[model samples]
Target: MLQPPGALPIRVLVVEDNRDICDNIAAYLEKHNFILDFAYDGISAMHLAVTHAFDVIVLDLTLPGMDGLHFCQKLRTEAKLQTPLLMLTARDTLDDKIKGFEVGADDYLVKPFALQELHVRLHALFKRSNGKAENVLTVGDLTLNKSTLQVHRSGQRIDITPTCMKLLQRLMEVSPSVVTRDTLETLLWADEQPDGDALRSHMYKLRQAIDRSFEQPLIHTVHRIGYRIAEDM
Candidate 1:
């Protein structure tokens, strides 16, 4: 699935041993609006995968200490994680693919593959596992439904444009944590931010829609940092 511009970026964990390949994947995926965390070894990959929630994991079959097969086995049996795992390696034999699947890989892709194909396969795995991307996100009394593309505050429906809806979704996804201006701009505009106070203007409109009628305010400015969505004391 081709993600529309301004859509929430999918968080990905990339476990590859080759530094050059890793850098190339990072550059390509980030440009396509996928947030990434890297790990060069199976041990480190397992640590990062268990600690953070990732939309998908791209793992290499060969590693320094632990290999990808063992990593997948441990992830499924020990961690009990159901996150989509895409095995990337040079092993393309029927036995290799079967082994990967037995160890809990959702998809397998050989080396020397096109980045576009990787992107498409990742989305396919995500969709198959998640069964549609719409999720109802909530922060305190505020609610945003991803499937319905609707926003509500304190049980009252609020009208917001698509731009405002994206901004609100980002803030609510990381509720109670400040979302810096740079990060917000990257998510919203994908490196093509407009001049002047466009973000501020949209933020003003969002605040009005979300807080204008409520007694307690939820959106807050963190001085020179960024903005967060949380109930005020």
Candidate 2:
């Protein structure tokens, strides 16, 4: 990973066993002003995905150790990583494409494809990823921007921790609707159940950060229920 000046550049990991193809891709993309990293097998690709942050990954389906489908599954199910994946495979059948999609590949390209087409597909994938509606909720004089993972309020931005963001997102989603304690915990922790007071501690911090600054507190605790974010006092 080449660390350049200014904001982080979009990183790409190309996983292909063919040295010629890997060299060609690295050379071509480097010319187009992109940071490229190479991994020869699915195991190495999985390691790179887990260790480093990447904007996109060009994965080959038939790889030693773990195969592309299994790798994609691990990234989504185990790592919970959402980096866009462009699958490269010789299996050009409709079934192959369907299976790739089912395994979380953002795009697929058969072998004997042009480098230009690959570039275009990667460009489209990046555009789609950035163009998606990531942020979904906002309250009175408050804004929750998911892209930057930030929360702003009253023309001034308020810093929200990651845990609070999760809690706040749920609160904002069912705005005006009461979020029960059980529901809140399920939404925040999900599968892993924390201590009984864990939710309370997080909620208190979120409310303090969001509501304490403003006169009209937007976060309302509903008795035995949970919480709600409302513009109306």
Best by TM-score: 2
> Each candidate: RMSD to true structure?
10.1, 8.0
| Local error of candidate 1 at residue 138 (angstroms) | 18
Residue 11 in candidate 1, Cα distance off native in Å: 0.8
Clash pairs detected, candidate 1: none
lDDT of each: 0.85, 0.80
- TM-score, cand. 1: 0.57
For candidate 2, write residues 121-192 as lDDT tens digits.
876777688677366467778888756767888878788788898888767755766667766675566557
- Pairs in clash, predicted candidate 2: none
Off by over 4 Å in 1: 132-233
Give the Å error, residue 38, model 2.
Answer: 1.5
- What is candidate 1's lDDT per residue for 1-233, written digit by digit as tens? 38877778888899999999888888888888789999999988887776567989999999987999999998787555678999999999999999999999999999988998898898888768677544888888888998788888888889999888878987886677777786667556754679997889999999999999988899999988889999863
